[model samples]
Target: MHIENADLNLLKALDVLLEERHVSRAAARFHLSQSAMSRTLTRLRETFGDELLVRTTRGYELTPRARAIRQELEFILPRLRAMVRGGDFDPATSTDAIRVNCTDYAISILGPGLLPHVFERAPNLSLTIEPLSPRTYDEIEHGRVDLALSPVQPPAGLRWQPLFEEDYVGVVAADHPLTADRLTLDEIREFPRVSVVVLPQEQMVIDRRLAELGVAQRSGLRVPYFEAAFTALPGTRLIALVPRRLVEARRADHSVRLVEAPTELAAPFPYGMVWHPRLNSDPAHVWVRSKVGEVAAGLRPGTP
Candidate 1:
């Protein structure tokens, strides 16, 4: 049987390639081989009469035409998905994998409570938590990540839902000599510090807070995850200002202690969930996002 426009699938491939900007990674999204993806890109260029993607010294970039079409594709694709699915999600039966983009810190704070809530309703569904990366925004825009949680707001054309606010406190080794419920600027500056960087362009919010207080952070150690910062304090004078909740969660295992930082330091930064406009109305996406919001609400201070 001859299928009319079997090539329609190539349009889907084109959307992925345009967002990914890398043929290899785009291929991985569709589980296609590199050579096949390259051929697909060649076909897309032929169909659109544009280069579509061009290699640069740094990496591949979409051509102007490709970029222009993406804005329209983002609008059409989700509608097309909803049309095809044609029904509300049944969590008990659906086994779809929900890809979540977040830091380990969020998993530490929300996962313990969130998982039970999600599994109770959707035992067959699975959640895959991915670490934050520079490409997280792109991943969401392109449909790779179903949801994202971060302190930084994403670009426009995405939904941002404020989940909870967080504040920072200084953490030190449980056996450290300085025995204060709170530390002054002079005391904090006494030791070399460690910092957490989520991605290349992203620095932790506390970095700005520290600079505001004129506290010189001797960043002898820099790590990617929040928990790594505590490892510096075991037998050393090193201390860091991490989320108060994070410190409380890990204190028992790491033998770390949390104390109030200088009075100049403010309360917690606002962290939130973000998603692409394309996924905003998808039933399954909405259901999972609702569950996440519920979990975040219960985890806030003074909630029973």
Candidate 2:
């Protein structure tokens, strides 16, 4: 691990040879002669006490030890290159891929606008938005996702940054009677309710607030996604309680009206940007999180 004694150039040459699997091709890639690459491979084998590559019927094969070290090399090589080329990241030229995990509501409210801004700034940077699964903490811990946007707080040992808070609102068809009057829990409960199957914590919060005020309602339907609930409200008497940001983002095109829920039943839900502590000091991760914060700021209350 000591940089002073390590053969950094040999490591690079070995990485290319491992990937190319042919000495001639590896030499071609590094613009070196085949003999030079062969010697480099010999140094690598002696340095590591392993025949990193062996001649095989299929050109070359990596030893088990080499295969084990491949992942480490892949991770470290990039950082090495980045360290050599010191400069601010230009998204337009960077081809980095960022992966984010988020709920359907976040995708609906923020994703549509966020992607374009990112692309405009960093055309070569790609994004992969994964569905926010139930075991969010596990996914983040295991590196299955880079960032997660959720209303729930991140589990212990993870870093959770509060992005913004959203208030609950009732969404009904544009012509629903509740749109004509101030929405109260009594009036909202009078109609069939469309419920989204969310986390147990969310259910407890809703039930606790409603029970405190003695409000009761019958569930008309249950859906897994907020988009489904939003689409289903066009002609039915079903009213859905969803985040105000989600409703506001779609009010222009969707035939839905956003009504303030009863204060007694309304509660502020805090949405956060969460990531593993392992990536706390990573520059790329910091950039991505800052972009997420910028998006959250634009959507915060009174931003309009």
lDDT of 2 at 94: 68
Indicate the TM-score of model 1.
0.72
List RMSD in Å for every model shown.
7.0, 6.3
Task: Please list the C-alpha lDDT of all candidates, in the order they appear.
Answer: 0.80, 0.75
Model 1 alpha-carbon drift over 4 Å, by segment: 1-3, 7-82, 300-304
The top-ranked prediction according to TM-score is 1
The top-ranked prediction according to lDDT is: 1
Q: Which residue pairs of candidate 2 clash? A: none
lDDT of 2 by residue, 162-210 (tens): 9887777778888776655347777766898887765533553455567
Clashing residue pair totals per candidate (backbone < 3 A):
2, 0
> Per-residue lDDT for 151 in model 2?
75
In candidate 1, the residue pairs with backbone N, CA or C atoms under 3 Å apart (3 or more residues apart, or in different chains) clash, namely 166-268, 167-268
Relative to the true structure, candidate 1 has a C-alpha RMSD (angstroms) of 7.0
lDDT per residue (tens digit) for residues 175-222 in model 1 = 878798887888867777778888866556888777777877774688
Find the 10 residues in a row with the least total lDDT in model 1: 1-10
